[model samples]
Target: MECAGYIDGAFVKGEGARFDVLDPSDESVVAQVTGVSAAQADAAIGAARRAFDSGAWSGLTMKARAAAMTRFGEAMRKRADWLSACAVKEAGCPVSSTVMGAQVHAPLRMTDEIVDLFLRLPEQEANPLPMHERVNPHFAVQSLKRWSPLGVVSAISAYNVPFYTAFWKVVPALMAGDTVILRPNPLTPLSSMIFAEAAVEAGLPPGVMNVIVEPGLAGGLAMTTDPRVDMVSFTGSCAVGASVAAQAAPTLKRLVLELGGKSAQIYLPDAVGRAASAALSVCTSHAGQGCVLGTRVFVPQERKAEVLEGMAALLATVRIGPAGDPATQLGPVISAAQRDRCAHFTRAAVEAGGRVVCGGKRPEGLDQGFYWEPTVLDLPDNSNPAAQEEIFGPVVGVIGYRDLDHAVEMANDSRFGLSGWVHGADRVKALEVGLKIRSGAVNVNGAVMSSYASGGGIKMSGLGRERGIDGLREFQMVTTLTIGG
Candidate 1:
């Protein structure tokens, strides 16, 4: 199949070179994409700029925008199967693991919430400047806070869960009346292309939503540095995200970067027994390409041996095979480069006096694809490369902690503070432990993250939130209008 970039209201076959999209399951060509040139990228940004300035989309009433978003969402639902299938082939995600959850369903549900929040936003609200009043009591002044849409946005998404990341960035920005040009990673561009089709089906005005595909960084650099683009919402690695920030600095564009994470999973004394089984959450799903998966597991020093044993037993039952297999619990990594990167990290850990309890290499029967076994490394300390680096593969590094304090200390020691997990029988203690961890979101005892709450990281993990009211505000600008008396 052939895929083209979507610009303005139509799909265009660019003048740039063609690149092949490979299926990681067997390293076969699933589709070929025509890359967008720098000129085409600038055209996309110009289209969004025109749409925003002309009020073709941004001038609509909140109700009309919400209704259009509803239609767009329904259109996406119609293509869920196609999107899921494309993602499985391009990303090597298992059919049964992330297909229905992150790839298709979750984004739809999130859209509903974003629409509701967008409707609830007050166009203008009264605010009393109490500090100013106290300082100058001679003159009375009344203030009103106004919420308005930021102009054009350049939404760049990662390839791990392509459609979901695009939806998470695009939907909220659109709902807040910001026109967007979505740029998906070239390796997995098929699913994101659906957004353009859905935009047309939903009757959105031209240039309100655009999708661009390119194999190199030039298109992304154009989006980040273009003066017409008002904001940039990006999701990728820390190194690339930093580069993006630096590029956008000269333009002074509003930025929402959801970057890397070396998150930790802490097992309280009472919940040490469950530590082994929890490894499935990281290893089994999409081969741990998820940015927030707790790859560093902190367990009690005394129960280290037991945890490793249980982990080995549980992982042994995981079915690792082709991504299309319904019974596959774990799939291949994104590509050959990713598989080799995982191996390099594991080897570094071993060289630093660590031992591999299981799965430091490829599976026995899977030689055709870029498959890496679900690995677990028993590290000598938290300083090991396997424990500290974001491997972006199905590998977990187990580090022994002296106690709860030591565990919290070790968890906060990392520069990346994205997500954390705590397992404990006592709810109060678990909550306390979660509070102490210096991360954005913390889950206790298998509780899932709420869509209503904001999701983002602190420190190096990321700069801004991605969901709920706070996420909506990320796409909006706040102005305080004062009435002088």
Candidate 2:
């Protein structure tokens, strides 16, 4: 299937530039997409600017906007199969994961809930003063104004989970009454453009939501630094996020970054079995391409052997194969380059005196795809580069800690603090440990993942949160007003 960019509510071809979208599973050209030029990116930004200024979207009642977004969500759900198939081909995700995307069940439900929250939010209310304690008759009551949209938002998402990440930025920006220009990752652009098509069909105004596919850094920079863009939301590596921050500095544009992570999982002796299962679930999910995976496992020194044994057993059960196979629990890395990178890291870990307890090489018999077996390493210490750096692949570093205090210290040693997990028999102890970990989100005893939880990292991980009420606030600006009797 051929896929094109969506701009100004219409499907359009690029300006004399294009790139092939390869199916990562087999490295075959699945679709051709236009690599939008700077001119096209400027045009997209212009379209979003005009849409925001025209007030066609911003002026609509909250209920009206909510209804429109709901319809768009439904339309996306209707075309879930096409979107999922494209995602599988481009992202090299397991078939089950692709099926989940195609259903649009999670995205739709989350977006719908966000819209409902927006509609139900209370309007700016006036703060009353004490009548008897008024110092002067001129004293007036002040109204606490809620946040309003920041106008046009430039959303640049990564390739790992295209649709989900795009929505993480786009939905919140829209809920805050902003129009958007989305520049999807070059590796996977079709799913985002498909989303734009659904928005147009669902009565989204022209220029309110535009998508452009650009193959390299040029397009991303153009969108981020565009004068017409009011805010920039980016999800990528720390290196790119730093560049984006520097570029947006001169313009002083609002920026939201969800960057890389070297998140850790702490397994107490009492919770070894459960923690081992959770670690496997995270390390194998999306082939460990997620920024929030528990890539670092910190266990007490006394239980190191037991933890490694449990983790190895779990890793052995992982099935790596083509994305569409029902039996496959894991799929190929996003590309050959990613596969090579993972291999390089594994080799480096071995040279650094780390032992590969479970997987250390590519799976057998499936040579066409960019596949790598899930890997777990027992590193000599927490200071090893493999344990500290963000590997962005299916590899986990296991480091033994002397005690609870040492485990917490080890987990907090990384510059990246995106997310962490704690396992303990006592809920209070788990929560206490979670509080000590410096991360955006902490999971205790394999609790449920909440979409409403505020998510983002500290230190080098990134800036700003993407979920919860705080996420909604990030896209908005506040105003205050006072009135006298």
How many clashing residue pairs appear in each of the predictions shown? 0, 0
Give stretches of model 1 more than 4 Å off.
Answer: 1-3, 131-140
Per-residue accuracy of model 2 over 1-485 as CA lDDT, tens digit each: 24345778777777737788888788888787667777777788888899999999988877888888888778877877876786678887777763354224567568787887676666565456566533467664545565566789989998888888898888878877899888888888878876687777788988998888877777678777878888899999998899999999888989889999998899876776675675577665788888988889888777777878888888888878888777888888888888898888888888889998888788898889888888888888888878878888888888988887888999999999899989889888888888999998788876444457678888888899987778888887777765555
What lDDT tens digits, residue by residue, belong to model 1 across residues 1-485? 35467788988886676889999999999987778888898899999999999997899998999999999988988987898798789988889995458877788677777888888878899886687672476776778899888999999999899998898889988888999999998889888878898899889999999888888888899999989999999999999999999999998999899999999999999989889976777898789998899999999999999999989998988899999999999999998999999999989999999999999999999988999998999998889988788999999999999989999999998989899999899999999999999998888777464467888888888899988778889998899998776
**Candidate closest to the true structure, highest lDDT:** 1
Per-prediction TM-score, please?
A: 0.97, 0.95
- The worst-scoring run of ten residues by lDDT in candidate 1 lies at 128-137
Lowest lDDT sum, 10 consecutive residues, model 2, at 97-106
Q: Give Cα-based local distance difference scores for all models.
A: 0.88, 0.80
